[model samples]
Target: MTENTQHDVIRRNPLLEAAQEEMRKFERRENEFRRKDREERAAELQLPLAEIKVH
Candidate 1:
């Protein structure tokens, strides 16, 4: 197959696009929850806010 045709095939892959979108959403929610959980734990332990990284 031609290189142009191969590129077109990859660009038109709906399944890959959908999976990537799902992962983006999942990561956003995961980070949000993780940050909240860390904040709660920090408050409980009286730890400084500078030590936790949710990203």
Candidate 2:
């Protein structure tokens, strides 16, 4: 393929960029529920919060 054709094929057009942003937003929303802090996990599991904090 010509250089211009190859470049065109690989270009990040607006639609593709918008689609990618939407996917990122969806992933972040899903991860918000999937990911939990230590306190949240303890509360969910009905366990006492530990006094020690681990980084």
Candidate 3:
């Protein structure tokens, strides 16, 4: 194995790993929020309303 490859594998160093995890979690949450917003908008658009006449 090359020295560079070994170095890359051993370079996690705790802080970097935590940062990467946080970033991944943030991205996942953002995607979920976007998907939910899209679904809600679609549902709203598809809703039907009826009007009543008053005397």
Candidate 4:
């Protein structure tokens, strides 16, 4: 194979895949915390619960 073709070959990386999965889980947890915090603050301010957005 030519040098460029050899360099362009795709490879599977288990470490990178695992890291990405962990990152997704971390983001989900962070979003949940932020949503809860927002809800608490809104309740304290007496704002309507419907006006608070979690998504």
- Candidate topping lDDT: 1
Give the number of colliding residue pairs in candidate 1. 0
Off by over 4 Å in 1: 1-12, 51-55
Summarize candidate 1's per-residue lDDT along 1-50 as a digit string, tens digits: 69999898888898789999999999999999998998899899998888
Ranking by TM-score: 4, 1, 3, 2
Better of 3 and 4 by lDDT: 4
Candidate 1: residue 1 Cα off by (Å): 10
Candidate number with the higher lDDT (1 or 3): 1
Write down the TM-score of every candidate.
0.66, 0.47, 0.59, 0.69
- Candidate 2 lDDT, 1-55, residue by residue in tens: 6999978867858679989999999999877766566668878888755665644
Error of 3 at 40 (Å): 0.2
**Span of 10 residues, lowest total lDDT, candidate 1:** 46-55
Clashes of 4: 0
Error of 1 at 24 (Å): 0.7
Candidate 4 accuracy as lDDT: 0.80
Q: Candidate 2: list runs displaced more than 4 Å.
A: 1-12, 36-42, 48-55
Query: On residues 1-55, what C-alpha lDDT tens digit does candidate 3 reach at each position?
Result: 6998878767856768899999999999999998677667757887322332312
Judged by lDDT relative to the true structure, which candidate is superior, 2 or 3? 2
Clashes of each: 0, 0, 0, 0
lDDT agreement with native, every candidate: 0.89, 0.76, 0.74, 0.80
Better of 2 and 4 by lDDT: 4
TM-score of 2: 0.47
In terms of TM-score, how similar is model 3 to the real structure? 0.59
